[model samples]
Target: MTLIGENGHAADTLTGSGFDFGEEPNPYGAAGFPLDRRYSHSLYHDADAEPHTGTGSMENLGFGAQFPGHPPFRASESFGIAHPEPFIPEIPQAVPDSQARLSVGSVYRPSLGARGLPDLVPDPNYVQASTYVQRAHLYSLRCAAEEKCLASTAYAAETTDYDVRVLLRFPQRVKNQGTADFLPSQPRHSWQWHSCHQRYHSMAEFSHYDLLDVTSGRRVAEGHKASFCLEDTTCDFGHLKRYACTAHTQGLSPGCYDTYNADIDCQWIDITDVPPGNYILKVQVNPKYLVLESDFTNNVVRCHIHYTGRFVSASNCRISQS
Candidate 1:
């Protein structure tokens, strides 16, 4: 027996050699009738064999007992039926650090995908490693090659014993480089930095923390306070371009009016002509005595500092004439 598919090719074929001559009646009784009763004596019987011996008829063309073998199921070595899901790389946490003189270290570069196959999935684990800005670049465009940048971490410091850790998150494409619009319009860029500037104990003073530069190893700015657009007029309301401040607040202990508090001040000093290098940021806080509280005998002086900011980058050092 032979069966042809819709494409006019032999789909299945069966011959006398493929069937067993000594087989019993069909157990399923197909075609709405019992096999033994339907064919009666017409069904072949093995006369030269044992009494129980029975056989199938070769006279029927469409009733062959065997079916053709199926082709082997094979899979592709590369992307098979369902194309392989794109491979998304993880963003490394250990990026370069910041430096003094307002210049930050360059961002750690990420690895690329296969030469032909590109990664297409959006990274699920994304974080703002650090928030940094350059100082020299902030004040004067002066020497384009010798400008400073600053950066801060996302975590804030509540007590004196806390080091904020920020993760770096880079844009798919840089501002002035290859594949201009490759990155999404709204990339995962913005991050928050912890800030604290208040009176400690009975002193009416403020406190601050500093972010060091990656290349110069100098303090870039204190905490996250270095990046902002605050007041304009100073003294007699004079205009000041770049400035950093520490917020001052007064504290009270109920019952007795607390009149004393300590002040905090975090400062930044810019440096010039520094070699680029990767660095880490560590915070140090020192308490200063201010107004005396009601209980003057016991001086309440304690400084709190926190390290924040992710990896930062400065303009490339190579000077190019416009």
Candidate 2:
């Protein structure tokens, strides 16, 4: 295939021949073809020329084009645009809600372990347990102080911007916690599941999981309200009046949500009660969990919640402790 130039001229016809970026001087116009003016670069091909390589490309035969096979090409290990392979399949961002989220197969071992052991072995340190999408929708709600309920009482509907912060606890060790104490400088490579991920070469397959301020599409505040609810729910964040936990993961515990090991984690977000005006509730996914694809169920999970009302505390609600 030959690359046609912007001048309505065929720069060079392929006779198993190569490309020439130089101007087409005295270019030939076919019988009914329009005359070729000096070829101007189109947006797609404007930036110099991409190096082309095929069975007959100059680079294949030792000539570099401006791009991959650029001409005057010093085979310098210098900089140049990197092209993607011809057919990298597109991974869908969203999968059906009810679809099976896991790869189907037995945990097969390829090689025999110390005398052909075939039975599944559990890691004594496996810590038995375990654990633990979407452009979130935003909503705005208004409030005014009806009466001073008390210090611990719900804030009367006095209108103020409700700020929100989302936190995702991971199953991995948390710092200063009694069990599974994690150090601040702990290397990411230390976790078993994480190590398994490295073994599979599937890290890039996941989406960039991060905490997002869904309304503003920004980072969430560390420990304060950053968004407001749009639905007509009393805006409260207090532990007693505002929140409740899901008995979903291993009965109780805190960590990012996961589909395996049966342990549960928690996500906490603070919502504000603003003075009656349209506002956007931002539920930013904690950045730590945003890109994880290991847990497929979470991939299709909508993170759906009906803003029942405002809660007072930034801390997650507990069911087991209750």
Candidate 3:
């Protein structure tokens, strides 16, 4: 894909994971918005282009090589030129009621543990916990997201927009918060289900971790922890807390943030066979675009690590758009 920058020039070749830059939605919709869930499918490549002699295209009646007085015209060409303004899928400068800005706080408490630690994943639902015990190396860290999306950025220009929707039995009654705007819908999500805790856990794929070898440019380790319980664990800001998972609702309200302590079950990435060297430990939240957030960027947090056979040290931590 070609990348153009704000300066109207080609940007430098970038590397790493791809991010959702709030591009225009596909033209497959015929509804409230292009990305709206209730969109009707349109004829794509199956339809042929309009021929020159078709109804408003040009004169279709029998005509000579040249007209007598003037060229044939149509009412559709009243402007003589067709200029449609480009749609910029920009995040609204003012905050929307239902817009949830997802972000990762930090990937702290990196630790190395042996494979198959006792009681690491004791399932209460009788579901097998093999996914946690199978990892050879464990490099666990914490991942969090906050609803203070509007507060994170001072300038609206830096924020990438999010167009989110969900499949529900009653969509008309459930609008995009206060506005009349409606979003496109997708498959229903229980967020996630964890057998270990025995209840619906975090939003599915809400957070994930990875350890990569910087020198070889190869993935050395993968984190087993992804499903996280979305709740208001803590909030340092002054905004009022409005959401709670205890009420059987799943979401992070403004000024609220949720965290999975680094020592949680299956929270580490396996890095057993990797040789000691420089590596990057990447942690991300909302990896699957499951939530309608204020910003798509700031979902990734990466840190540089130097790992010997016995020890690992993380430094130079930074955040970027996924």
Best by lDDT: 3
Across residues 29-100, which tens digit of lDDT does each residue of candidate 3 receive? Answer: 112111211110110121223322322211212232333223344444666664543332221121111221
lDDT, candidate 3, residue 266? Answer: 44
lDDT of 2 by residue, 155-224 (tens): 3365234422222222221111011111111123431232311221112111111223435645332221
Q: What lDDT does candidate 1 reach at residue 158?
A: 41
TM-score of decoy 3: 0.42
Residues forming the 10-long window of minimal summed lDDT in candidate 1: 99-108
Candidate 1 lDDT, 236-262, residue by residue in tens: 123222211222221221111111111
Shift of residue 250 alpha carbon in model 3, Å? 2.1
Q: Which of the two, 1 or 3, has more lDDT?
A: 3
TM per candidate: 0.17, 0.19, 0.42
Candidate 3: pairs in clash: 19-322, 36-184, 37-184, 37-185, 100-293, 191-204, 202-228, 202-229, 206-286
Per-residue lDDT of 109 in model 2:
16
lDDT of each: 0.21, 0.20, 0.34
Q: Which has the greatest TM-score?
A: 3
Model 3 worst lDDT run, 10 consecutive residues: 166-175
Q: Which has the better TM-score: candidate 1, or candidate 3?
A: 3
